[model samples]
Target chain A: MQLQYDIEGGNFTKAGFASSEIKKVLKQLNVDAATIKRIVVSSYEAEVNIVAHAYKGAVTVVIDHEKIVMQYQDEGPGIPDIEQAMVAGYSTASPEVREMGFGAGMGLPNIHKNADDLLIESEVNKGTLVTITIYLKQEGGQ
Target chain B: MQITELAKLTEAQVRCGNGLMHTEILYAAASDLMSDVLTIHHDGMVLLTGLANMQTIRTAEMSDIHCVVLLRNKKATPEMVELAAEHNIILLESPFTMFKACGVLFNAGVQSVY
Candidate 1:
C-alpha cells in the first residue's frame, strides 16, 4: 500500500494526522505493535520537523509485507549542513518554536535511531528530502 | 499505579478523559520535549509534561501513551482537551512543577522510562 499526505508548516494542531493514520494502517495490516510504534514515532518526528522548519511538505509511505519506506520532502529553508543537523544539540529554530517544546535538536537523531535506514538530501535555501526505511520483518530470519 | 491515584499524588485535576481515570499506569515520562518522549516505548506509560499544546498530546497518541499530566499548573487548551478525549487519553493538570510532580510520582512508585 502507498499513502500520501500534505503537511502545513507551523500548524502544530494538524502535525500528527499523517503519523496517526500510518499507525492505524499498520495496525490493521497486522504489523507487530513494536514495529508499528517505531514507525509511528519516526513518522511523527519527521512530520513535526517539516511543520517546525518548512513552509510546506509532503510525505509518501510505501508498505509491503516485508518493509515500509517513508519519504518526507519539504519546500523551505533546507539544512545547510546535514552533518551538523544530525547532532543531538544542534538546532536553528527560533525561540518561539523552541518555546513550543520542540527544536531541541533531538529530532533527526531520534528518527535515525528508530529507522533501520535513514537518507537525507538537502539544499541551502530550496528544500529537504528525508527518507526512512524500516523492515517489517526480520531479514533472513523467521 | 491507577491514574486516579497518580493524580491524587500529584494533586492534579482531570481536565478530560475522566472515564479513563481507572486506567492503570505502569510507567511515567516527564519532559516538555515531545521528541524525547517519543523516543521511549513503554507499556502502560503516562506522560508528565509541562508543555501544554496540541503537539504534546499528539506525541502521546503516537507513542500509544494512556495519559498526559500537564504540570506546573499549565492549562490544557480546549483543542488539546478535545483531541485527548478523542484519543481516549486522560488529560490532567497539576499545580506542581515538573520536578515536584515527578518526585511525588517517583516516591509513590511510578517508574520512569529512563
Candidate 2:
C-alpha cells in the first residue's frame, strides 16, 4: 500500500497527522508492534521537522510485505551542514518554536536511531529530502 | 500503579479518559521537552510535563504513552483535550510543579522510565 500527505510549514497543529494516519494503517496490516513503534517515532520526528523548518513538504509511505519506506521532501532553508544538524544539541529553530518544547535539536538523531536505514539529502538554499526504511520481518518473526 | 492512584497522589483532576483511570501504568517520566519524551521506549508510561500543548499529546500518542500529568496547574487546550481523547490518552492536571509531581508519583511507587 502507498500513502501520501502534505505538510505545511509553521503548522504545528497538524504536524503529526501523517504519522498518526500511517500508524493506523500499520496497525490494520497487523505489523509487528515493535516495528510500528519505530516507524512512528521516525516518521513523526520527520513530520515535525518539516513543520518546524520547511516551507512545504510531503511524506510518501510505501508499505510492502517485507518492509516500509517513508520519504519526506521539503522546500525551505535546507541544512548547510547536515552533520552539524545531526548533532543532538544543535538547532536553528526560532525562539517561538523552542517555546513549544521542541527545537531541542533531537529530531534528526531520533529519526536516525529509529530507522533501519536513513538517507538525508539537502541543498543550502533549496530543500531537504529524508528517506527512511524499516524492515517488517523481525528476526523472531512468526 | 493505577492511573487513579497516580491522580490521587498528585491531587490531579482528570480532564479526559476517565474510563482509563484504572489502566495500569508501569513507569513515569517528567520532561518539558517532547523530544526527550520520544526517547523513552517503555510502553504504558505516564508523561509528566509542564508543556500542555498539542505536541505533548501527539508525542505521547506516537510513543504509546497512555497518560499525561500536566504540572504547575497547567491545563491543556481544547485542541489538546480533543486529540488526547481521539488517541485514548488520559490527561490529568495538577497544581504541583514538575519536580513535586514526579517526586510524589515516585514516592508512591511509580517506576521511572530511565
Candidate 3:
C-alpha cells in the first residue's frame, strides 16, 4: 500500500496528523506491535522536523509485505551540515518553537534510533529529503 | 498506578477521559520537550508535562501514552482537550509543578521511563 501527506510549515497543530493516520493503517495491516511503534516514532519525528524547519513538505509512505519505507521531502532552509545536525544537542529551531516543547535537537537522533535504515540529503538554501525504512517483520520474526 | 490513584496523588482534575480513570499506567516521564518524550521507549507510560498544547497531546498519542498530567496548574487548550478525547487519552490537570507531580507518582511506585 502507498500513501502520501502534505505538511504545512509552522503548523504545529497538525504536525503529527500524518503519522497518526499511517499508524492506524499499520495497525489495520496487523503489523507487529514493536515495529509499528518504531515506525510511528520515526515518522512523527520526521513530520515534526518539517513543521519546525521547512516551508512545506510531503511524506510518502510505501508499505510492502516485508518493510515500510517513508520518505520526507521538504522545501525550506536545508541543513548545511547533516553531520552536525545529527548531534544530540544541535538545533536551529526558533525560540517560539522551543517553547512548544520541541527543538531539543533529539528529533533526528530519535528517528535514527527507531529506523532500521535512514538516509538524509540536503542542499543549503534549498530543501531536505529524509528516507527511513523499517522492517515489518524482524529477523526470525522475533 | 491507576489513573484515579495518580489523580489522588497529585490532586489532579480529570479534564477529559473521566471514564478512563480506571486505566492502569506502568511508567511515567516528565518533560516539556516533546523531542525527549519521543525518545522514551516505555509503553503504557503517563506523560507529565507543563506544556499544554496540541503537540503535547500529539506526542502522547504517537508514543502510545494513554494519560497526560498537566502540571503547574497549566490549562490545556480546547483543541488539545478535543484531540485527547478523540485519541482516548486521559488528560489531568494538577496544581503541582512538573517536578512535584513526577515525584508524587514515583513515590507511589510508578517506574520512570528512563
Q: Which candidate is the best by TM-score?
A: 2
Residue A21, candidate 3: Cα error in Å is 0.8
lDDT of 2 by residue, B24-85 (tens): 99899989999888888998799999998999999999999999999998988999999999
lDDT of 1 by residue, A1-142 (tens): 9999999998877989999899888878888778888899999999999999999999999998789999999999999999999999899988877877888899999999999999999997899999999999442334
TM value for model 1: 0.94
Give per-residue CA lDDT, model 2, range A50-114, as digits (tens).
99998999999999988999999999999999999999989999987888888999999999999
- Cα deviation at A16, candidate 3, in Å, is 0.6
Q: Is candidate 1 or candidate 2 better by TM-score?
A: 2
- Ranking under TM-score, best-scoring first? 2, 3, 1
Q: Provide C-alpha RMSD values for all models, in order.
A: 2.3, 1.4, 1.7
Q: Identify the runs in model 1 with alpha carbons over 4 angstroms from their true place.
A: A137-142
| Candidate 2, lDDT over the whole model | 0.92
Report how far residue A129 has shifted in candidate 3, in Å. Answer: 0.5
**Candidate 3 lDDT, tens digit per residue, B15-109?**
99999999989999888888889888788899999999999999998888999999999999899999999989999999998878877788889
| Weakest 10 consecutive residues of candidate 2 chain B by summed lDDT | B105-114
What is the lDDT, from 0 to 100, of the residue A60 in candidate 2? 95
Evaluate candidate 1 and give its CAPRI docking class based on DockQ. medium
Query: Model 3, stretches more than 4 Å misplaced?
Result: A138-142
lDDT of each: 0.90, 0.92, 0.92
- Model 3 misses residue A47 by how many Å? 0.7
Sort candidate 2 into its docking category: high
Q: Residue A92 error for model 1, in Å?
A: 0.9
Docking class of 3: high
